[model samples]
Target: MPETPQLQVQCDAMIGSLHINADFTTTHPWTVLFGPSGSGKSSLLRFIAGLWKPQESHVILGADNITTTPVYKRKIALVAQQPALFPHMTVRENIAFGTESNQAESIAQMFDLFALNALADAKPATLSGGERQRVAIARALASTPRLLLLDEVFTGMHRTQRDTLMQQVRSHCVAHNIAVLAVTHDLPEALEADEVLRIESGHISAQGSPHAVLSEECTAWIQGVTSLREKL
Candidate 1:
């Protein structure tokens, strides 16, 4: 509603001559990079996050062109499929890492926001996959990221767990007005994204609402939504 946050990414990158030219803007708070494995979804995320530099690109967030900016200064947080938590630190410490001295309140909020209160004292080695992911997300949020990159974050969770956590992620992003780019090949995962960009063979095939971009490739989901609408 405020109309402030904006993300624009354009890249002509290559991984071992597997060329990929992607151009897209994240107009919505949550945009999904949906594609099959090896379609360069994760590669694109890496380029945006500054984990990997693209040859020719312009990545702008709000007023800053972060293409050449350092990773920490870009105000972007990436939570990979395997949660990268500090093995030695407790959950509380990990979540408070990016926050400032007034971290007591933020720690409490992360606990409540991600249901991590019960695991506050636990180390990364002792936490389950889902718990680790929750903590990673909390830590990222505590840092006050302007853009969040989620790469296959539901690998270790059950369907119900993934669904619940996804809802939480959406709520958190919306509340903070943080832009999110989620990479996934799962149809159901793409369904939850605010906008969908269909990537195939290192290129974007389509971009729109799920039902719109997926009409031909994913008629089943479209028909399912139609059936539900009819029932309502």
Candidate 2:
């Protein structure tokens, strides 16, 4: 099957009290939005997810213009820093939520691939941070979304856990031909993406392959933050 066309987002929005304007055009399988706090990465992702409106924005998925589409109708899956799983729902229930009846078996297989089968009956409150994030991902994938937005979903994971999840995310996206836009302050994490976009003072300052963008001054600032984060 032909891969789904990657996203094309041009937005101007306010995050908290800050105003942001960003334009991105790329066909990368995985794109990383890299910036420190307050740079508007999360806000942009929220805009794409239909969680927030952009003052003036255009969102095109494949050939359709979904700028005014409602969140549920957008078919976009967002996994935030906090897993946001339902505490009362079992893993199966959470993953199956909003999914078609024919998708249940596929969702179970996905959970098993993530090694979350043992915790299928466990609630989010009782799961570890990594497990919750994994389940959250599984839930998102179960919906067969046209686009996936990941907002620092690996924030507190250990190196091993992070690496494992990253690989799984990449594999799953490729297999499903899903377009992914991930936001993070972690340089190493950003490095795993096929393309990286750097935002600062509410605008896109640089965008390209990870190595290309890493050489720019804005990315240098991001690298400084990443360095300090590693020290902490």
Per-candidate TM-score against the hidden true structure: 0.90, 0.90
On a 0 to 100 scale, what is the lDDT of residue 53 in model 2?
80
lDDT of 1 at 68: 91
47-130 in candidate 1: lDDT tens per residue? 889989967788998878988999889989899998888899999999998787876775687789888888888999988788
User: Once superposed on the true structure, which residue ranges of model 2 sit more than 4 Å away at CA?
Assistant: 216-232
Tens digits of per-residue lDDT, candidate 2, 22-95, equal 88776698999988898888888888888788667988888878899998998899999998888999987888
Error of 2 at 22 (Å): 0.7
lDDT of 2 at 94: 89
Off by over 4 Å in 1: 1-4, 220-232
lDDT of 1 at 119: 88
Model 1 lDDT at residue 132: 90
Clashing pairs in 1: none
